[model samples]
Target: MQSVAEFDNVGLRYGTDAETLSDISFKLFPGSFYFLTGPSGAGKTSLLKLLYLAHRPSRGAIHMFGQDIVTMPRARLPGFRRRIGVVFQDFRLVPHLSAFDNIALPLRIAGIAERDLLGPVGEMLSWIGLTERADARPATLSGGEQQRVAIARAVIGRPELLVADEPTGNVDPDMAVRLLQLFAALNRLGTTVVVATHDIHLLQEIEGAQMVRLDKGRLSDPTGSLKYPPRPLVLRS
Candidate 1:
């Protein structure tokens, strides 16, 4: 099976600054789960930006869904981005839109009919335990609620690849585990999941999740297993 994404000798720099990411290389296979862990300035967010097509690398190649994204025309990025879901650490919900609308945004952007959105959107609202708060705007929701909304929004589209930056940072431990389980469930359904987090305890929540660590803008895998084919996750009963 074709890998969902591959990076070859990737490096990224901002303006005249030294590279924020250097010599990064990895492959993310379909249906696999990955955790990107590193210190605060380890370039995890920068790497994720590249993964979700938010920024093009200053050097090296990035291929997603079998296409070279670095050289792909900027005009076509929106179409490619539709195939990936991103959950930003800031929650980035539209202030003017209610939680339901925020979760429904992707489907609307995909041009799904208005009549067809109620079912999926409603289900997602329920899944996040926010069905009663569906009409509440981001400002009205608590941090954890907003985070849950963001997660629901990211996964509601069921994109082929899901990239999240510090998804569990704001929640309590229980909610964090619940969110991880949500991602695990999505992974079980064949969506490639990549989560960048500082919480080491969450690493064991999903069996067979490959770990990729970054420090001072460099990649390192002590186990040397990240570059190999993904292992199947053994879900606990």
Candidate 2:
């Protein structure tokens, strides 16, 4: 199988703290669905940051489309990033932009004309089930609605790679199912999807979705799995 991205013994660190991620090695196969899971303080977000080229790995190598990202010319990073979509955990919606406009921003950046934006952006809002909220600003919408807008924006452009950080955290169970279905549909169409999440229950929601558990700072399986592992003991004697 072909790989879209590869990380060889990747490690990342903050200013003076210990490495946030260590010895992370994996190949992201083209057109696959991956769920990155771990407890708080785990390196899920850090890993995603590396995936989307937000932060370079502190050590080891990362290759996207067979090019070494660490050594890639800084001027070319935007071109690489244009081939990927990211749904930030923070929801990062522009405070003043309406939901529809926020979802349309990516296309606009890609040079789509304002007059031609309605079809796809409208469809995205409908998929987000927030057509009524289309004109509402992020500050006016509920958390879940804002999240939907963020997701709608991320997936609308249908980039080759989609990296979502805790995408379903703000939504309800049913809406979560809907969002997972949306991702699955996108995956089937050849978009590689990696979702970073803390909700283990989502592991069962998407069939054949590969689960990569980050313990402390290492991957549970380099190949990864969807099956649930034994739950950690929490009750005190």
Candidate 3:
């Protein structure tokens, strides 16, 4: 299978002395659903930030959609990000915006037509059981409802890759199950989904999920390929 994203001996350092991620590497295949599991502050969120183009690797290389992310121009970043959908741990919705508008933000930014936007947004909202709350503001909605809105918004563009960070963390157990089902359905339709979470029970119940466990910035399974290998030099001095 073709790879959607790859990190080759990637390391992320926030400052001069601190290294949050050291020599991490993994390949996310197309149409695969992966759980990025790790304890708190294990660089799971940092890794997602790299995947979504929020941060560039301090060492090594990351390829997204066949382009080298470290060297990707700032002007081109938005276009690359458009190819991916990200659901943040915090539902980063605009408080003043209506639920419909929040879900429609991506399409609107992409300059989609009004008529074309309504159908999909409406359909997705209904799918997430948020149809009646379309006009409600984010501040008025419950946590689960906001989470569903975030999911709907992220998947609104039918992006090829979806990276969700702790998507089910705040939702009830039943709602979490429903959200997982929704993600699975999207995966069937060819979206490569990577969900980062600490909920082992929830992830275990799902069948055929490729689990990528991160420990202190290193991947556990498939140790040989992803055990924070040393960066490859194009040519030794």
Candidate 4:
């Protein structure tokens, strides 16, 4: 199977005294569903930030789409980012933009035709049960609604990889399950999914999932079913 992303002995330090992530290594395969769980301040956010190219590793290498991200040109980062979609913890929607515009941003950025944008954007909004609220601003929507809108926007382009940070944090349990099912559906269609969350009870109920637990900036394969050796610990400077 082709690998979508790999972290090789990656470590991250925010400042002189803090080690955000240490000795971290993992390979996310194409069409895989992964749940990243850990306590708060355990580097889950940092890991997601690294995965999204928000921050580079303090040491070691991160390979995405067959290239070393650390060595990639800064001018090309945005193009690389377009290949992956991110649903942030904050639901970073443009408050001034309507839900439609917000979800259409990716396509618009790519210079997609105006005629072609409505189909995918509308379908995604409907899939998330937000078709009725498509004209509303983010500030007017409920937390769960905003979360769903954020998700719609992320998967609107059907990215090769989807990285969601604390995706279900604001959603009710029933809706959380629903959202997870949405992700599962996307994975079935061949998009690699990596979700960072601390919702153990919710994730454990997901069958056939590859659960990666991070503790003290270290990673583990909970099922131990993979033939590959365990990912090594990433050390912080």
User: What RMSD, rounded to one decimal, does every model reach?
Assistant: 1.1, 5.9, 7.5, 5.8
Sort the candidates on lDDT, descending order: 1, 2, 3, 4
Model 1, position 160: C-alpha lDDT score: 94
Q: Which scores better on lDDT, 2 or 3? A: 2
Residue lDDT tens for model 3, 104-207? 99999999999999999999889889899999999999988999999889999988999999999889987888888888778878888889999988666566
List candidate 3 segments past 4 Å from native.
222-237
Compute the lDDT of residue 87 as modeled in candidate 3.
95
C-alpha lDDT values of all predictions: 0.92, 0.86, 0.85, 0.84
Off by over 4 Å in 1: 235-237
Q: Across residues 80-171, which tens digit of lDDT does each residue of candidate 2 receive?
A: 88889899999999999999999999899889998899999999999889998899999999999999999999998898999999999999
CA-RMSD of model 2 = 5.9
TM-score, one value per model: 0.97, 0.92, 0.92, 0.92
Best by lDDT: 1
Winning candidate number (TM-score) = 1
Ten-residue region with minimum lDDT total, candidate 3: 228-237
lDDT of 4: 0.84
Per-residue C-alpha lDDT of model 1 across residues 101-139, encoded as one tens digit per residue: 999999999999999999999998998899999999999
